[model samples]
Target: MFIFVILGLLVCTEAQGISAGTPVFVLKGEDLLLNVTKAVVLGKFDDFSWKCNKSNIVRFTFNDKGASPHYTGRIEFPENNFSVKLKNLQEADSGVYTAVVMKDSGDETEAKYSVKVQDRASLPLLTVSSVSESSSSCSFTVTCSSQDSHINSTFTCDTRTCSQEGGERSEGIPDTFLQVYQSSGSIICNHSNHVSWTNDTNTIKDVCHQQDDPEGLSVCLVKTCVFSVGLIIMVSAVITVHLMEKLNKNK
Candidate 1:
């Protein structure tokens, strides 16, 4: 029993009573195309399926579909090819596609397609909340969080932990002091490739003013000004009273 195959560009297995088949390997997040150049007779395949493998992983499958009867005509590739769709696949989906050919002449041809999957980076994140304006006397807290993580690692993180900082990561509470000259109300935050950042790119579009001081709304600044003015008035009054007492005592 011999199997003869018609492959393009490569001719190596063409001997009588010889049956040969090979396996194809593709990477993750990728597609692959395969064709039988050699003639595989009908009536030989009992079972055919796909299987994927990774570390600490074993055989895997995609579609457990059988054939459509032997050789009504050979299925051409690329136009309706099986190999072209194996590109840019996922790591969990990487595996082997086994094709079993049962020949009427008591011969069998077995072929396989092996694939490897890759990782793709996802979009970033954005959040807006409170800042120094939340309170005039108390502290205000604002935080940004991202959704990306290292797919293959173990981690423990606080609000500021990132994938690049292996193992456990903790972020310290930060308090940034800024002059509240105006009410800057808008915030922009971004999360990209497992990283997070923020800014006031909205140009502080809308800052509501206090009813008492419509022109200047920052209570922190107003309080400081009131304290300074009161101190100055008290000092001036004390100096004038002391001068009057001295003049009266001299007379």
Candidate 2:
């Protein structure tokens, strides 16, 4: 049951970063048996720091059980020689880990390992709204949000319809889905309303898709009818002249 237990209170959420050293990770309550004598953190030196203290660890803020929790963790090196086990994990308990190693000559090497908990994929709330109405289509925008203050994620937008998304947000308003077409659950049915690039548009117009096309098509109908009537008149005049010539010849 010998394990290196790093306390869970240290989440990296400030301007000061970890010292230029190695990082390591171990479960809070998990027991591990090491076949090798040592382990250390490995990866890029810039994004994380190594060690088990405030100067050497990175913090991740997450939600836990009914409350919130913080993860102050570091990466440990040389995992192949040792085995690790975890007891309990919370939202504040993500295992994105790396390690840094310093040799006698002062040159550094990095080891990397990713600690991912499979059970927690908290889907944020997705909100869709109609913005404006255009001639042909409608657009809806979607936004995802989480209650935790520390987790800011970049969002990617996509849908089966022809609607598009623009301006990816990482700080706030992670993503938005534009409601363009009037589908089963849509609030409106106008192309302009459905195809806005932002989520804050307050316009709620529902121009009919079929009505717009018909108005444009009416111009073509007028030309077609005129041509048809002209052809009929020409045929009628020619037939009348021929009938008169035949009757006069017979008389």
Candidate 3:
């Protein structure tokens, strides 16, 4: 009997820990609705209350209801259910919220939620750092940046398709991520979190063609210099040979 009781207590503690760790993500200035999964019958329960970080935010009895002064105008309890709606969530409001129920039969039930409020992710920026082109293919290096994070990735593209040479690159914040990848003919930089996402895109053809003009001009200049040097050398050699023949004839 003693062993069975100890096992039962351990199981109950584990279950409670799992429930208390339920994560809820919300955007800043957004409203969050927290619901109790278990049924709450008014007549069977003596009282119920909702607490945040161990501080009571709302309390309800069979006939009476009250809310904490700190949450006076920002909370709502709907008549249709035992759900609490929190409005205008801010970073300061992020905490663990628990709903507790006390029954007349000396029983208690509780549900916990861990809430995190975050701002929307900023827009991502994509820039090409260097590009190389050949007759059949083009390759380039690009950097993707968002906020304080950045990633560098290389891509190769042909006439028909584009592929990433070193796969995708990514950086992560607490709950946010920045990534660079290829899709279709474009390279995309994405910044995202559980609440919001943004991206920037550029085409492979456009980036490669932009670099080709300067490279082509440099190649043309080199070819012109080589041809001019060759012509000058040939003319000098012919003049020297003609002079030598004339001098020999005079002698």
Best by lDDT: 3
Summarize candidate 3's per-residue lDDT along 1-251 as a digit string, tens digits.
Answer: 99999999999999887767689999999998878877887774478888899788888888888899999999997656577898899989999998877675764656788899999999989999778888767888988988788888888766566677653546567888888887766788889998999899997768765333433444666889999999999999999999999999999
TM-score order of candidates, top first? 3, 2, 1
TM-score, per-candidate, Cα-based: 0.24, 0.28, 0.71
Model 2 residue 124 lDDT score? 42
| Residue 83 error, candidate 2, Å | 3.9
Candidate 3: lDDT over CA atoms? 0.82
Candidate 2 lDDT over 118-177, as tens digits, reads 232233444444534354444445444434312211222122223344423334222222
What is model 1's C-alpha RMSD? 17.8
Q: Which structure is stronger by TM-score: 1 or 2?
A: 2
Model 1: per-residue Cα lDDT at residue 76? 23
Candidate 1 deviant stretches above 4 angstroms: 1-27, 43-88, 103-107, 120-251
lDDT of 1 at 23: 35
